[model samples]
Target: MPEVPRTADPFTAADLVLLNGTVRTMDRAGTTRTALAARGGRVLAVDDDAAVRGLIGPRTRVLDLQGRCAVPGFIETHNHPTFFGLTLAADVDAGSPPNATIADIVARVEQAAADAEPGTWVRGYRYDDTLLADDRHPTRADLDPVSRDRPVCLQHVSGHFCVLNTAGLRLLGIDRNTPDPVGGAIHRDAAGEPDGVLAETAAFAAHAAMPKPETADLAEAIGLAGDAYLAAGVTTVHDTGLGLVGGPAELDAYRLARRKGRLRNRVRAYLVQDLFPGLSGGELSPVEAGVAGLGDDLFRVAGVKLWADGSLQGLTGCVSEGYACAPDKNGLLIFPQDDLSRRVATLHEAGWQVAIHGNGDGAIQAILEAYAKLGLDPLEGDRRHRIEHCQMVSERQLDQMAAAGILASFFIKHVYYWGDRHRDRFLGPERARRIDPLASAVKHGVTFGLHSDTPVVPVPPLEGIWCAVRRTTRDGHELGPEQAVDVDTALRGYTSQAAHLGFEEREKGSLEPGKLADIAVLSADPGAVAPDAVRALQVDATVIGGEVVWGGAGLDAAPAAGPAAGGGDGR
Candidate 1:
């Protein structure tokens, strides 16, 4: 079981034995075993009951599986950890009120204001511009009557935009002369006055005006995000765009999490290019290697992240064809092509992995062109460059990714959450049928992973798998039957594919002898379940580093058998 030779210390000592369980190892050939033992955080043995039991000692914590199934911990490919932390730290939750309209939002803000002091602002998030009853952003005019005493800002679902009331605008000192910053937009009405809706950088501007979260509060937010993911069966999360917003304070927050032992799941943080002026706009420096991959397995900075375009649902994602809802707009570029190319090239030249957010076909093409401009050769051994949200890829874009040895982490949930809107209002039937193009990328031999752009959607890997496997939307309509993958492929996208992205394939992902003992105990084998039932499976327990971190018997308390619809623990 301990075959790999290494000078590096093994995770810990084997103190746990998971026996009599269906372990979907996600091994190289998709092997399934019934028993496994963990010592130090690495797997000591993986085999049948007798074989694995032999490795267990008196100190071992034995977990009787009761015939349940286990798989690798889910890895989220694209997410904003610090930003999510800030959201958790904020008092507002605009996204949670699904039925709330403009009036409802104003009332909620008014109440939040009353609850707080006169000076404290009221903040909320998760607004879907498309679903707004007004089909447009609400401005200060709509909120002034409800609450003029305090500032109010509602973040859009994309996290890239926000709408502010008059108080918020005035507090932020954003008047007609404030002027939009480069790479950001300040929406204006016909008369050239601020419309209260700030796009991209503009929204970030409003956010900057607010008081920063206290260091202790930021650490707590990070802890909350970690605990939430761990409860949902995620052992690792790619902080797709950390350090992109929040400035140096956010970096300090993640650092604080590691320092305070608040971090549970592993984090492979990809720093936002804009976070570091030197990395973002200045010359490259090899000195970064000293700090790169710092920290233990709890968290590490692995690469640099950049936003090339916006999202599809909001009609800001750079698209090949104009949006079905906004045919006149082709989506906005977050960064100019020359600047992005230069920055990517500089980062690449300095030996940092570059992860770009490219959701649309046009954006993908632009990213590819930018990467090409850098002229960096794909290095030998696990150098996996990635496109964060390769939602709408053209065949040509797929070829570029394949040729560059780039991995396209597809947003599989797009099919589930936005498929209907995409079909009817965005891509239209013909093009919408090919939206995600997962199967196409697989057929092309391009490496890929699926993701839930958390806060954008919830951060669950299984949800993405359900979307990919079923290719079904909220209405239960299968968007593209041809794009659907079998359960196994979808599982690998979260497990193996994700591990490969993190350069941890050799130590994690699979239930192999020499791999890390990160696993999830589920109520049923996803592989054996019917496609439709995949989303209904429940997680009974979650084990990371061979330790049971969450629900075992208390799992029965999970809302799986309720009048409320129960979905599987996202992968």
Candidate 2:
């Protein structure tokens, strides 16, 4: 076990002591504390109210918490900060109501085109076809009205597909003669001409061609994203898909942001697999890392990320069995099996954690095989290689995972965002019943974690917890009741387990004295509430290293009444 700090003298009191609160330490023993003190960035003490009060000195900033519930701030396991910031800062938000139609999407794009620099791209994101009134993806024809001269790119809600206008396609040189890349498709019209719909790697190509943002602009994007995450009580985020920050300039953008004091929370990043030089198999040079590659505490590169397949919703996630919705397709795999295994072995041999994006069963199988071939075990040591969206895992695979010490960072929010679609369209009920199988993973002793896969789904931690606990879809349908976990386990998905996913458990996850003093102040205790009431627990404030970064109990609007009488997490 690790050491926990204790208070010294009253004369040298800690920097801050948040007392008189119901704080869940989220430790394995389920310890609870009424007060905690912090000196440096790390926690100083966890003691009872009276003893904690005795240590408070004239210089200490004390927060009463007013009986609010405090837990370790959320550590997001899978998110894209650059994309999150970029989308939030520039793109049209077509994910919500009033813009849930193709016409609305076009109108929004038109407005953005008018505002954007002439000849610059008009970008929009997060348009869900299922929620749209038209119930279909917008095409080049629909987007032409938005911008005939300027390129237009509308990212799909799944983040696996994107629609481009004719001008955008021309900019990227996609036409009838362009052959589809392996494992990805450029959807073609009946005449065999490209239809401006790019899936999987094809979409990535279009994104790569777009004009890169200035470093300061990128920094601002990161700052905007950090503000949102902090406001939502996310103290740490493991930024996946470093390919978005592809070049040296993009990588430097992060260090510049941190140097400028724009980074508020911790960042653990994974560079894209392609960034490493090699065709058959290769290793990442530290020189390629620039400065952000090597890390201190605030920002670090945890590993390399590889995408083995696409998304389940986008129907590109590699699967053994055929899709229930689209009978002809079983989805696609990005790399040849031999190529993938070699790459995985190369990285594993280099002793770096590898995070693979796999959704369907085939992708999961490939990743598991790759790790097993290396004879690695995380439980035995700290070999925390991960499967990013292990959504379609099998029962036997779960056992193998536990035995091999593999980690599954399930996209649990799929239950809320695409659970109904999965049931009715994607997986059919039988397989859909197992999406994000938290309970089964627990049963098999797999060290599983949950994530929102932000920008794909908004980064709302409470809503994510709610999804894991209730297993309810957007339409109030329970997709997998048996898979639903208790509130404690769900909270752990966001806190402790999330830290373990990033190999950051010792420093940031739990509210231990030695851990960083990152805390989220909730209106009520999650464990004290009924499973369904968990989502309604408003985040009153968030503390990062004892400094209040967001809503404070007294600084912001007062919280609503505490947990109601009906719900109870009193397990």
Candidate 3:
């Protein structure tokens, strides 16, 4: 831990102050304070109401929190802002709540086609085959009725698979003779024809083939996503896929969003490795030309994002053992071991944080081997290289990760969204119970953070924290009681631990005197409430850089007299 820097003047006037609230500093000792003051967008002091009142000036805005609780703002370790925004703006919602069956999804697509201009593609997203009444993925024949003239593409909830209509497949130039790309598959019917189902790289290719959104539209979408994140109390986000939509154009959209004052949360971008071919070439890539911390506080190019496998729910993750639902079908790796090793070495040697998505134990092993092959040792320096998702990590893998100082960002929300199916259909009881394995990771001393993988799931940190602490399935059954972490640990996963994943722990995370004034004011303290009720806590206000960006309203005005004139019992 670093020392909190103080100003030369002991009694510097604060720009903002909050009195009569429970301020959870989230420091090393889990300290709690009654009142807090901020100056120059950084925390100035946090102490008893009377003590902090001394720093409040006439110009200082003082918010009476009553008996509410305030803690460090949530940090999202892994998310897809571009994809999430695009889906929200243009794609049809095929998720379970809206579409109960394949026919429902087809009807939605048919409606979209009817609404769209001729030759325009109709796209739908977040359809879960498992959750559908049909209990299977929709095929080309099912979607063909929506449009023989217009193309239709429906993406699985996992984002690793997609079902395309005949026109959609042809639009992407896929046919019976089109061989599957390395590390991806094109499902074929018994008659030796493409079945319109593409997985991994194949799905990625189809997405890339689609038309890119206009820059202004993309910027608006990003702004919408940012508003959603801020409403959910997220102050910082790690965009795990930067080039998901239009490569450099996506980057341009971010710049536009910032310029238009639409970007709300601080962003740490991880460029998709496949977008830059020069990474594997002799010369330096465009991203490599810049240093790791290339941008301002609002946005920065932090690392290179890679993938070792696909989603576990999509049944495309590379598992060591076959899925219980499909005995002969152990998922496939997205990259050959050697190729993955080369990519890791290339990005690692170039001084970029390499974050690889690995959802299965087999993929995790492959990633570990790649690191071992390069002889990369984090003990020498804090590389902080991370394994994203890490859903199916084993005890041995946890030990190795701890030894190597490799951090993990777990998609802990899976327990709440897909735990029952995972337990009974995917991994069987034993393996499914170990999904995420937060307790084992703590015991093995592996530094880890929790994530929603949002747009795959909703972007609610409280929900993620509740899931980590409860380990309960949607069916209201406990999937892994032994793996449940304490309330404090679960909160840390979204706060301090998440900041550590992005190498911004000292700057944000905790509400120290020198740290940025990024805090979330909740209706109640998560720790004070029952574990099951944690997710029910409402975010009353979100403060970023000493400014209330959401839900403040009349609270933004300064006190008429001074902090002493209006002070509560520091509840």
Candidate 4:
């Protein structure tokens, strides 16, 4: 086992002590103890109840876990906090369970338009054309009925495509004469006119053109998102697309959120490459401008985010073979191979950890090729370059990633939400069955982490862990039992492995002396529960830096109140 740190004064009193519980110190040896102590926002010790009791002083806050289970708090590796927050605060929810058809979505938009002032853009999100009764993306004709005078845009659940009304097309100055961007498409009708569906860069351009939410509203949204994460026992989040909304000003919104006491979780932010001039045509990239590791622990600019391809479910991910449903149609790459390689090499050499989104096997291969062009041994350093959503990686790719030391952050929830479609329509049985392939990655000696990819999905780490372990689809069909991992491995994907992906292994990810006292108290030990019942285990309390941030009402320690509970530079 790695050496655990101890305080200089063994008699120093602890700020908090949790006793009579299954303390799973997710350490190198997987130590288990009945009690744990914390002081100065760091773990003091983990031992039997009697051994920890000595650290409890007169002012120590004690909580009796009553035999419940306590493990390290979850660390979400890839998510879009700014975009997710804005969606919750401003956008219309056009997801299924509420709107089953295209007409239903049209009606929802009509209602939203009626409620809003005239001429303002009406946006809807999380609409899945594949799941809709119409089985097609909404066109300008369908959305025009809502309001031809208003510009309306409906985002696909995949976030790779969107349907814009005629008014929106005109607002963005896109038409039949407009040529498709190098890495994106403006889907056209039989008449050679843009059909209002934009893919990849096209959709991204439209989103960038749309008006940004007010800074105050953005801060509140951040707070709301943080509250949700805290309730789910997530102590840290990797905002994979920083400056995604409102460009560089989005960083200011984050600072505002932190100042208002709304930003609670530790955020390791990745600058969206497209939004930065340095990554584009400018001379000084953000890294050169000293933006890397800019903030304190609460919010730090960690790396740069790039996209290799699009979403698989949306038929935009670059697959090695044609889609099972559309044999003639292979997805597109977001960047040319040479362009991607050059960009990656430039960023890697500039000291930026690059996390490229690659959902399909072809895209994964492209990313690997890009890494290879760097001509540096990945294993030689702690670069920790990552491939996000490596959903369709094969054994060969896993071996390459293992040899190259690239981390795979799998969006494991896809098995539960889209596994059936992937098997039946997207990739066919063989490929779909290997989607996420946690067991194969493990066998090939590749390190991996699990993510929800919120607001693509909710930030429930347990659901991701369950999906990884069970490999079951929404309808309870086992999509790939062979790829299923054990509970401990699944847990580590969300905890230890996730922390490592963000380069934060020493400060977080486990319960150990000298580590931050970030923990989640669960109703039951997930490892002890039946595999099928693990998802049912609730988070009873969440502690961040030795402070109870959510739940814990029954304990003597009151949960932190409002924005004051957030950590870091009193910005």
Better of 2 and 3 by lDDT: 3
- Name the weakest run of 10 consecutive residues (lDDT summed) in model 3: 1-10
Candidate 1 RMSD to the real structure: 6.5
lDDT for each residue of candidate 4 in 205-242, tens digit (9 for 90 to 100): 98888887778877787888888889898999999988
- Arranged by lDDT with the best first, the candidates are 3, 4, 2, 1
Winning candidate number (lDDT): 3
lDDT by residue (89-171, candidate 1, tens digit) is: 66666663453577666777777877888887787877776666766677878877877778888888888888888888888
Residue 113 lDDT in candidate 3: 86
Candidate 3, residues 162-207, lDDT tens digits: the string is 9999998998899999999988999999998999999999999888
lDDT of 2 by residue, 368-418 (tens): 888888887664677878999899999999988888888888899998888
Give the poorly placed runs of model 1, Cα more than 4 Å off: 1-14, 284-289, 376-382, 554-571
Candidate 4 clashing pairs?
Answer: 261-563
TM-score, cand. 4: 0.94
- lDDT for model 2, on a 0 to 1 scale? 0.81
TM-score of 3: 0.95
Candidate 2's clash total is 3
- Least lDDT summed over 10 consecutive residues: which range in candidate 2? 562-571
Choose 3 or 4, whichever is better by TM-score: 3
What are the candidates' C-alpha RMSDs?
Answer: 6.5, 6.2, 4.4, 4.8
| TM-score (all chains, Cα) for each model | 0.91, 0.93, 0.95, 0.94
Tell me the deviation in Å of residue 350 in model 1: 0.8
Candidate models: Cα lDDT each: 0.76, 0.81, 0.86, 0.85
